[model samples]
Target: MSKLVGSLQGYIWRGYLMAGKNTNKLLSGQATISSKSYAYSAKEIYYSTLPYAATYHKSAVTGYDPTKTKPETSYGAISRSVISNYQPSMTKAQIQTVIAFEQAKKSVPDFRIVDVPYQASDGTEMVPVVQVFSAPYRDLDDYDHDGKWTTEATVRNVLLAQENGSGKIFESNPEAQQVELVGPQYAFPDDDAAMLSSNYYGIDNTTRIIKRVGQFVMLSSRLKSGIFYAKASDLITLNTNKPTVIDGIPYVTSMPLAPASPNHYVDTASGKALKAAGYTKVRTLFDDSMNEYRLKNGVWTDSLFASFETKIFSPDFDYRHVYFNVSDTDEGKIKSNKVITLNEGNNDFKKLLMAPTETLLGK
Candidate 1:
């Protein structure tokens, strides 16, 4: 019988397709639910603001009289006015662009701009004007042709030069020779020893020595107290009173334990080592039986011998052919052994089966 020949199998196949549809619906529904929640929250905020606005206006107009029954504007009318005036004027795309711009501004601190309201050329209505500051510069003389600096370094240098009387003055026209240095007015002592002898003049010898000693100590500690080399065999404790035994293996005092090298039996050269250790591909039943031992369950147990069907024949025979002139039968048998029995109503199994096929088919 064919593996796909069953009503239950057909149902399972169709169930996989249905599961994909359900998954798409679920994902789309999640977006809808989020949008609905946001709308509900906005509605709640809009309604909540009405009472506060009503109270504030009533208190301001009527001086918060306790005996007053009603305000000049009804609460319902205030709510309606708020709802009409406070309706979102910006489109979704515009809102998203604003959000993105705000996020970008936060991430990149150099980007700064402000919206200034200005009257139009017609002088009828006010329009928003985007005023952008000069981009930050990293060095002096890094300004554009318009003389707008684009880096922080340029701005800092200009400020420092201005304070030090070395900056150029640009009033109507540029002025030259703006900075000038004069000769020092104070005199210096001729004797270096007399200058050193003055206690308040400079650091004393004792303080210098203390500073040097502290620096040396810090450097030595950071360098792990100077490097020292030793052989691996010499890394052993010489304590005879307390013996070190790990995992039932006793280590001799003052004697180094060399780590065993990993066995690389996969390499051709290393396979010879396995051969030297008496490991072979073929072994008789008696040779195998010799390795079996009686377990705690009072039963002798040996290594399991697993047989698989294969077309190839070799000296290393892990597989055995049981059927003669029946390759199709062998294939069928192998496929039957590997059959995955999924439940009819299992959505997970359906998704697993359909997702990959759909992805491959570009569905």
Candidate 2:
């Protein structure tokens, strides 16, 4: 009886070990099967959706060039055409009345009008008066080498001189003879709170007048009635309270106003003019704490605050005529001063102006 009991116990122990091994093998096989199934499903889904996802993902991974792609109808072109062609059924007098009402609402008390003269195509004199709302309080001793800050009288004198000249001012081109100031002069309040207020907002409002240098008079396009100094033969018109028809030509106050200069502030602490400072493409310092040390001859020194230096050279008295050079350890000497003359066949100026707008619109 004792032997039979021991044998039964031995058989039970062996059965327990075999069951444990079989259970582990079943679990391992199930795990392997589950992993294979998951991988197969994942591959199938990826392959199936590859055709659909390729349209969006491919362009993102590889940079897209618009010039290389086929031309497509753009929304800007469509919208511009629609806006230009669409006209309200309102009468001309009604439209003028509405415009007058808007102008009356924006009438500034401190603003005064100054008439600028321009010669018309038919040898007739035209005057386009601009509303001067603000002028520099501090007198400029010798700004622009013209002996003083630009004023209405000074601008007029410059234009008169240009008109009296027998030969063109620019030797290479006749159209480039006239040099007009094409930017906002007034220094508006930088405070955002003051800008939001209606009273202070219109107080700093000023107009941009394109007066030819040495012939200081308003300029107009030769083919059109607008204020555009494209050629020497461009006409000048008289300023009126409203668009007035003198003789046979209709004279209207239609000139593009220049926006305020972005580089309006000067950093007095650093003795650097914010807008006048040269642009740096790369940073030299490895850390922000190294700003106190300056890079000299490829070695860092604690004497200066900057790691690099920039120099701007203006060859002629022309403000636009400028050449810039930067000195750095990484780049020994870099110069950037390529002149692009705006002649009859050259569209470089137009391309430069449009490039920024196009990049913004594309994004």
Candidate 3:
């Protein structure tokens, strides 16, 4: 039997395509069925924004001969494996409801609408998601010139008709969905070398680097007390070698830490340290918003912890801004954004799928 294509992040998975087969093993937490009208499973799959355009030769950067690599015809199409997890037993009405819910909540930065069509092995219908933009690239020279790739094939943050206007939309839709595409990012799973790649950062910037395990340092976000501390660990490699201590607490520097970049945070190495230390998740509180990241199978995952209507204060200007140690039941006053409700469909959403490639690429 031929293997089915499943989107994890945005990369295709081969044999591990079945949605329910050993699902318990794949998820860090137990799976449960929701009782809402738009009922869905609580099973979480580690996903990232599709890191590349719909059709780029996989062998381009690896220097592999194209002739030797069997081309993937379904390279950019959203696969059934992803939609099934959203609602393994979803009826057509339920599927449509899910789509409506996503479209209504599109204001969330990472929220995307699954607009393509799919079918299950059992002949069930499934809807697909369109990725808002391709993965972030390093430079125009490397992504466009040296690689012989178009800006449409590399750049991110494409404008959509729904978000922008009809004047900015890509004509030929990639026929794909929003899920993590597992690729080179997982190759060097055990080292900071993976962090060196520009594909990791969503924006173009000089990638600061550090070497050796001892160079790792942890910094706290600036607190109300105007103090920040750093701690060193061999479990991960940080971009800085400098560690400063204030009030018996070591910090990366006397600076305010923002949770914009995970590299400035920690990689899988540090993720393991966090897990082993009995921390369920790391919450990065920035101004009015808080985001949660988890390490499953030694890979860091992106998840929103909360969106505070008012600024979040850590009670004291201390480590609470960055490193969080708490149980799931201690959510205090933070509101959960996972609730989904059905709404009328938006036709502009379909145009938003692939209408901004040229605009984003500056064509």
> Pick by lDDT: which candidate is best?
3
TM-score for each model: 0.13, 0.18, 0.17
Candidate 1 weakest lDDT stretch, 10 residues: 191-200
Can you write out model 1's per-residue Cα lDDT over 1-363, one digit (the tens) per residue?
011122223213221112222322211232312222111111111001011112332233221111121211111111223222222332333223332343344443321111111112112211111112232233576642221211111111122222333222211211211111011000011110010000111111111110111112100011111111111111222123222332232222221111134321121322233234433321111100111111112211221121112223445421111111111111112211122222221112112221221231234
* lDDT for each residue of candidate 2 in 1-363, tens digit (9 for 90 to 100): 001111133222211111222322212232312221110111111001011111232232111111122221111111222322221222223222322332354652222111222222122221212122232233476432211111122222223323443233222222222122211111111111010101110101121234444322333322222222222221222232232333332222221111134422222222122112321111112111111222244332222112111112323322112111112222222222122332222212212221221231233
Q: In model 2, which regions exceed 4 Å deviation?
A: 1-103, 110-114, 118-125, 130-332, 335-345, 350-363
Using TM-score as the measure, the top candidate is: 2
> What is the full ranking by TM-score, best candidate first?
2, 3, 1
lDDT of 2 at 59: 30
Model 1 TM-score, 2 decimals: 0.13
Clashes of 2: 19
Better of 1 and 3 by lDDT: 3
